[model samples]
Target: MDEQLNHAPCGFLTLSEDGFILEMNQTLLKILNYSHDSLIGQHVNSILTVPARLFSQFYFFPLVKLEQRVEEMYISLEAGNGEEIPVLINALLRKVNERTVLECIIIPMRKRNEFENELLLAKKETEAALKAKHKAITELETTLKKLEIQKQELLELNQQNQKYKIETQKELELARIIQETSLTDPINNDKVQMEVFYNASGELSGDIYGIYQIDQNRYGIILLDVMGHGISSALITMTLHSLFQRLISAGVPVDLVMKELDSHLHKLFDNNEEARHYSTAIYLLIDTERQKIDYANAGHPPALWQDPNGTQYELSSTAPPLGTFEGVVFKTNTFTYKKGGRLLLYTDGVDPLISNYLAPLVRKTVSLPLFQLKQEILQCLNNEKKVDFKSDDETFILVDLK
Candidate 1:
């Protein structure tokens, strides 16, 4: 038994009841960093670093003495190098040959300490990485919110722009309706018979014409073509209608009306340096009792006269367009129509559409009844393959004297 205890792989020691080391193996001497001679007479608690008074005051010695054994108590041992070494200790109290003694075993814990330190370092690194990822997520959320706000603002702006466009279109349509009503009303009690047909390419037109009765036996007719198309041209036509109505209602002469209208327009548009604005017109006064028609053309197409015996002829222009020159004398042509005669006045848009296939039909002048003439013109236009419905404003007026 002594040989087996001496050659054991682990450290073992025996302590007397007075806490003095009684016996120790060579392994205990080496593990404690002491020689057997140094440890044998010393107190066991003196080598352990823990005070012997702690075991006595805590009743651990009494429990061991009464229970005869205690298992797995952890303690620290001080090496010769002054480093703390962890150890697992077991103690057993027994009586051998009438002497009570305590037996203890010591085990080292170096590898367990190394594993715990590595675990602490790994936890710190994982926490730092998680903090960085959280910060990036917060920044991305803020940027996404700002972009959403800008998208909403752009959507609101588009809605407002669409609303303004709809309102402007409605106002323009209303103005067009008013202009049509003013131009198409025929004044009764006239010496001349007058009828008008007008078609516009869009909601508004540039072509304008009307008949004004001066008295029971005398009447005046005007066909005006404002330059350009669409809203710009329609505005010019409206301006002319206003000025002419005011002057003729004030009993102005037919020739003087054109002179005053030109002067007024020149003054109103003098500040417009582009000078691209002007209107071409024809003004005619017919005296049914005397069978004479007095007419002045201002850069407009000649009027066609059809006699009772089926003779067709054109009355040519004698002056430049109105608003082109100030104080220009307009020549008035006098032509005597038979009691049963017909006259036709039209804008340029009318013949140009038919001229595609009816170039020959239009060039040959044929005098026919009013209804027959209108039918022939329509027939010529219908024969064309590519008829452009999106033509410019067209107007034609036919007057028959019975």
Candidate 2:
């Protein structure tokens, strides 16, 4: 019986009430040009055209439930290669193993002359009705024309929007590349060594830092965090990068540089109320010859300093954040740092991750190497359960003064 059913004259398919294909005969697979494994357990709509799926959802299921059968239902089935095949179907709703199923026998309509004749009869009836309502027919035609024009306009607008999006994505990617390249490279020397780890939340970063050599024994280090991140802040950071290089290389005092930067920001955003922005920064001039670091902090996070004896110190902020007020005189503080000590600088993004464990981390890991210290900080952040560390751009700089 199974062999005869598989090679039957018509295609046979069994589907669940929810339109999933439960079983199908070899004849159905051959007719749809699909492999047995591909169609088994597939949804019935996967093999149905758009209109056929709509018809199955509304008329086919309702009629089967009302009468327990569907007879001579004409529908189009989509084949494996996307070809539409018109078929006449007869289905029976029955219970097998206490589960209701739809068993459909489909006959391929290769010569659709009968179907075309039926459509012609329906068209003739519609034409007779239009003759009695000529004004309504004319209004419907005009409305259809307007709808077609609107659809065409929407398609054009969508195409333009897609093109613009592609161009904008390309531009942003290029900007990100340029910003990355503009960042400072690692500084290593006999007197000091520095390493930086930075992660941007988006395509661009608002944090910028650099180490510049001022003299044979003096090196200037600056880390700045703009108001927020992304395009606008990144642009300001790039501008600051150039300005900072020039100022530090010229051996400007830390206090004077902070004052100049504050004035510059005010001048840039003075007229624009919407673009009121400020920044926090810490500038350090490390003198290996004098064994001291002259630093200035502008409402930024404190720098963590650890001596060789496992003693930790916090270099707190000395002034308000930049762009806050004009004519501000920044103060520079000096700290004596011994050889074999380490300093940690970071943006506020790192605060939430290590706020509770920073002192212990610095004290315990002070004897470890700089790279190991970085690993320790990372492990601590990973073990933290209270905060999402990556919610903002996280950047940290580790300096080993040797």
Q: Which candidate is the best by TM-score?
A: 2
Give the alpha carbon lDDT tens digit for every residue of 1-402 in model 2. Answer: 289998999999998988899889988888899998898888998898755664575457766898999876668898999788988788999999999999999988664454445445555555565576655776656555655555565566567557656755765676678777877876888988887888777888988888888888998988989988876777777767887888998999989888888887887676555666788999999999999999999988998888878788888898999898777779999989789998988887766433577767778776687788888877765665255544666688899999
TM-score of 1: 0.57
As a whole number from 0 to 100, the lDDT of residue 44 in candidate 1 is 64
Where in model 2 is the C-alpha error above 4 Å?
1-137, 382-390
Model 1: how far is 346 from its true place, Å? Answer: 0.9
**Separate clash counts for every candidate:** 0, 0
* Candidate 1 residue pairs in clash (backbone atoms < 3 Å): none
Tens digit of lDDT per residue, candidate 1, span 331-386?
76788888767777777776643334333443353445555666676665445315
Clashing pairs in 2: none
**Model 2, C-alpha of 175: deviation from truth (Å):** 0.7
Q: Pick the candidate with the highest lDDT.
A: 2
> All models: lDDT?
0.68, 0.80
